[model samples]
Target: MHELIVSPYMGRFVMVKPGRKEGGTMPAYLYRELAETAPTSPCPDWLVKAARQAWHTELEGRPLAPAVLVRDDPGLGYGRASWELNLGCNYDCEHCYLGIKDFAGLELPERVRVLHTLRDAGVLWLQLTGGEPMVDRLFTETYAAAYDLGMMLTVLSNGSRLFLPKVLDLLTERRPDRVTLSVYGATEESYDGLTRRKGAYRLFKKGLDAGHEAGLPLSLSMIVTRHNAHEVPMMRHIAERIGAPMEEYTNMVPTIYGGDETLPTQSAEHLRRRKPFTGCNAGHTFFHVNPFGRASICKVGRDPAVDLLAEGVEGLSRLGAIADSLLLRQGGCTGCGLQGTCGTCMPLVQLYRKAEAPLATYCQHREKEESV
Candidate 1:
């Protein structure tokens, strides 16, 4: 049985395995030193209480509960979890990440079990995403379950189904921690053109209007592509008019299966000029569980994953090893000159590469950056 040590305020959790033997009766001064070395954050009251409990128990010539002591330790650093509920979508966007595959995801009961496992594993924030999470039949069931377990839930949707009475009612009743709407284009011609669907812009607005009427806090995101990049300003204005903040993302990588080439990527200089966010926060503090109950550090990390339904908590130990193996020091990416500017890392290289070395697409970016 694994134990979860939770800091309620900071929403950080450490998972402890059986017979770890890291914590026991120790000097008070040593414990203080260990606490000081832990991640720099405002220590929560739950941590303070756990520490006091540990000290009192230790004074009595016994070891404190592992959960109490694990607070000051950094063995486990899981905080946020993302679920790709299903890979089915109504509107077919050209630059879809999962491509146009229609995958039959985990059934309701299995999804419920996975959610329980995640909560028990000390996940604090749960983000439900997908081709459009709201479009899934089990969306409400899973959302309700997460809400019942007190997990902070966020829903990512295209805003097409939001105008439905049932959809509006469910959101009104549960009121997720946050709701994000992906706006393809500001106008119908551009939006429908990108989505390749007629009457999409009207439906999207209907969803946004419904979200606002339900009093749900909505955030807007636009996938910046050559097809719709010019509409960014107009999209921002629409977001502002609707009283929701907007963000633009231009980093369009290849699909998981490497099929879609419809959306053109940003220039190497443009990608390099932005802040360096090379390694993803996969198994470290973030996780992505696809609809098939396959869990990985991030969405694009499909090749290396653990089937949560088959293994349960015992399988999560792989995540820590995954995090370690993905470190920059563990691979050739360590001394590379294009460290910050280049986005290719071991995990991504593993995802897109066809041979032992990185693909030309990644090297091209690095080469371009070098020449400049």
Candidate 2:
């Protein structure tokens, strides 16, 4: 495995280290020149200069072998992707968007195939997520495969299994770009109550401390639900104590399957107003995949997904059009006068409508246009 990756990301050239802790942009011409350099040739002076400036590494006279320099293919224009390894989780939180958590996923053979497919699809940045990714039986294998294939990996977990020797060792050996753990609460009582799992908080704290001690790049998602809304201050304190950046999430939406069971968990006081819906490069520059290899424009707009395993990379040809159609303001949003100021995107609005959720939760129409 190379210590550095020189690759094309959505039309831009980037020089990134393995774990992605440090990186910066490089000239396109230089990237091409390096790509054409002989493997056994001396490491180019430009690389040394860039590495020194960007990563502060001293590669004075190293050989230009695959271990020192890995070049990534700019495949199919897709640069990033997220995959749900499985829907299984140890802690079932009240605010979880996955309605039904099942302990099932593709076997090892199929999982490896999916990872290769992701690599071939030009995914340099890949997020391995799940109901709780660590709970999947083949989680470590899948992670290792992706990392070895030169993708900068990110793991989204609940911090419940990071303390285990196997999990910690694997992470320490092959560090991910980031380990994003969702913090449910600052106290055991509040955390356990919110997750509906007794003693869940203890395990989470242990795992968090271990991960930090192992020098892993970690971040915290401060999940604010009605059950733990009072602990926001303490959550911030915990994040600061661990020296990891924290982001608060207050807008609780319906489950991915359009179930309204999670709506009650929203923290009314902490619900922040979303920014105006500009636009996203979801299907054009990136995509998402489920545990079963179904690829979609993004996690929110999962319909019209392509069976990646069956159709292969060519199937992704349909996602850009799918995204375009989904983004069109239709159904409940059609001809809405508030389209200019609405913050929610059409796909998410479709989900809210499917759940028959209160308009106040997702729309400005009820509050502004109708009332006026």
Candidate 3:
């Protein structure tokens, strides 16, 4: 194995080895530096802004509920909840809509206020996701505060920045119960091919190793795409190597970039190989906050005219009525072979101008997989 040099810290960037490529063992000095300071550059600036928002709410004394999961009975544990904490990221990997160029940062406090509102409304399971949440400096204090509030905090990340010894220490100190890392590729070429970089595969792997060494509860998250879908085995290999849980989902939304082409395309074989899914429980369960603060029904819904934050949750529920319009209910859902047993693909409706069609590949490929 070739010796990999530790790369200097870029903005929230943790594993860009400098002197050598990352095919072999990591440099000893790099490990020492990581042990010293948690990577702080990748942290987003909006975290502070979110705190300010919480302060404003405190001053106003107006209590707002967050994504509340109303339980008729009980038995529910840490009901599902997630927040798209920001729109910034450290890489421009294919299959990511944010790979588009015009992405900007979200105001920090506004997000914090939203969290406060949601937590107050009974949200317990919290997921902070973005280009990458670990890079945001605000995560330092936010994780601490959330844990103090008795909220189970989780960070959805790319595993690029977590390699720094310091970053790993901070995560351990905060002790976030869960960190979901998206493993793009197992090898450097496959990972670089998707991320459009030459060495992202190594950086991601190194960071993940650091996170695991820190004794954090880590899970591997994957988006099944044609470009990297074939690498599913690779992702699984990673999960096995690290003892992390592995999960993969069909394309949630289509390519929605305004200008640049060069988007990812999944192969029929890959789409077929993907776990069969039917519809999405998005609006009925989860939702998204756009860069401008509009709370849309799904990640691809960027309708600024219907801003959920501005209108509030009530407004959000009302606006998503657009989702149920006569036109959306199309596609033969009745008597479908995979109806009750499969997950929803509802996000595709808004992402594509056309009505949601049956994922032919999904239906055909998994027609014979024995029920688990």
- For every model in order, what is the number of clashing pairs? 1, 0, 32
Give the number of the best model, judged by lDDT: 2
Give a tens-digit lDDT track for model 2, residues 58-130: 6668777764555566458989999999998988787888899988878888888887887777888999999
- Score candidate 3 by lDDT: 0.53
Error of 1 at 180 (Å): 0.6
The TM-scores, one per candidate, come to 0.74, 0.96, 0.62
Of candidate 2, the 10-residue stretch with the lowest lDDT total is 66-75
RMSD to native, candidate 2: 1.5
Q: In terms of TM-score, how similar is model 1 to the real structure?
A: 0.74
Query: What TM-score quantifies how close candidate 3 is to the native fold?
Result: 0.62
Q: Give lDDT: candidate 3, residue 160.
A: 85
Name the candidate that leads on TM-score: 2
Off by over 4 Å in 3: 1-79, 99-103, 223-231, 250-253, 256-264, 273-281, 301-347, 354-372
* 1-372 per-residue lDDT for model 1 (tens digits): 103232331232332212121223444443454455443343444444444454332212222343333333323556678999988887888877677657579898899899877866667578999888888988888888876665667889999998888878876776666788998888899899888899989999999988887788788987776677777779888888978887777665666775435325443333423445456667867778989888887876665788989988678779867766765443445676656666455565554553233344554465565788
The lowest-lDDT stretch of 10 consecutive residues in candidate 3 is 64-73
**Which runs of model 2 end up more than 4 angstroms from their true locations?**
369-371
